[model samples]
Target: MSRLITLVTAMIATITTPALSQTCPPPLNGAVRLVLVTAPDMESTGGLLQLFARETPAHAWTPASTPHPVRLGKHGLAWGIAFEAYKRGDEREKTEGDKCTPAGFFRIGPSFGFVASERHNYITIKPGETVCVEDPASPLYNTITQRVQLAPETKADNMADTSLFRNGLFVDYPSDRANKRGSCIFIHIWKTPDTPTSGCVALPEPQVKALQQFAEGGAVLAVIPQTARDRFPTCLPDMSAPHDP
Candidate 1:
C-alpha cells in the first residue's frame, strides 16, 4: 500500500511539473469587471474598446458600454513580456521603445488624473513632482514616483501633462528592466483621434471618464490583437460581430 501511494504521488508531480514552465495567458479568475481592447491586426494603430461587467464573480460578462474608438501605439500591438506565445513565428515580444502596446492581460487602475477624483484612491498628478520612470538603469525603472526621488538626469514621463493626461488610469503592466520588456503604460486622454501613443492606450476625455467606476472596485484590462483573438475566445467578446444598439 505504501509503495502504491508513493508511485501515485510521483506520477502526479511528473504530470504537473512541465505545466509550470508553460507560458499561457493568465486566467480571468472570475473577474466581474473587464476592459477589452482589441485591434483589427497587429499593425492597427486604432481599435475598438469597451467595458464589460457582471453582477457577481460567477456571472458572465455583459457589455457595460458601447464599443468605442481608441488610439493604440504607433507601432501597434505585441505579445507582452510575460507571454511566451507558442508557435508565435515572427510575432514580436514587447520590448523597451518598441512603440507597440503590450498585448495581454493586465490589472487596471488606482485611477489617476490632474485633479482629485472623488471615486477612490485617486492619484492627483503634481506638476514637476509626480512622474513615471522610464530609465531602465535606475532602481525606480517602470515605477511611479516623485521627481525628487531620482537624480536630475533620470528619464521619466511627467504625469502632469494636463493636455494629454488630465484623466488617466494606471495600467499595472509587469516590468522587466533586465530584459527591457517595455515600461510606463497607461490609459489616458488623447491628443486627437488620429494620433497614437508611445505605448499606452488613449481615448477622448469622455470615454476615459467612464472608466473611473472601476477605480473603486477592480478591473482587468485585456489587450489582444486579432491574430491572437481565438486563443482566449471564451473570455472575450466577439469584436467582429456587430454589437447591439
Candidate 2:
C-alpha cells in the first residue's frame, strides 16, 4: 500500500507541475492592455498615453485616474504627456507644466478615414472638428472636437499608421465628458520619421495589424496615469515611459 501511494503522489506532482509552469507570461514587449493618460492629453489628442485593464470601456480618462482597458484602433496609437486641466480658449494657458488631459472617457469611432493631401496620404478624422462634449457649437459638435490631427507627412511616425491607415478606421468617442473643444485627431504616417504627433498616437502598419489581432469585438482608448492604475483593477501601469518595468 505504501508503495502504491508513493507512485500516485509522484504522478500527481508531475501533472500539476507542468500546468503551473504554463502560466501566461507578462504582456509581450511590455505591451499595454489599454490606454491611460492625462486629461489635457486626451482632449488635445485622441490617443491615450496611459494604460489599464477592464471588462468594459472607460467613460472617463485622466492621467492620474485609471479607467477600464479596451483594445485600440487597428491603426491607432495613443499620445503621451501630462498637461493641466483648462477650458477652451485656454490652450495657450495650459502647458506641459500643468499636466492635464481632462478626466473622462469618450466613445470611439463608428467612421475613420485617411486623407489624400494631394502631395501625400494622411489619416484624417471623421471630418469636421472634434470639440469638448460639454461645449456645444464647437466645430466637432455632437462629436469629438478641438482635438489635434497628425498627418502622415508631418511627423509622429509609428509606421503602423501609413500601412494600416491607408483606408482609415472609424472612431467612437467614449460617452460623456467635454468634446467639441477641438477636432481632427488621428494617427497617420508622416514625412519626418522621428517626428512626434501634435497630440495623436502614431504607429506603423504592422502595429495596427497587431492591434486588430487582439481586439476581438472592438476596442476603446482610455487615457490615465500610473497612479490611476493603482486605484482601479482595470487600470494598467504606464509602460510607455523610458525604461519602464
Error of 1 at 24 (Å): 8.4
Off by over 4 Å in 1: 1-24, 240-245
Spell out the clash pairs found in candidate 1: none
Provide the lDDT at 207 for model 1: 78
Candidate 1 C-alpha lDDT tens digits along 209-243: 87876545988888887777777646575554321
Per-prediction count of colliding residue pairs? 0, 82
Question: The CA-based lDDT of model 2 is what?
Answer: 0.33
Tell me the RMSD of model 2 versus the true structure: 13.4
- The lDDT values for all models are 0.79, 0.33
Point to the candidate with the largest TM-score. Answer: 1
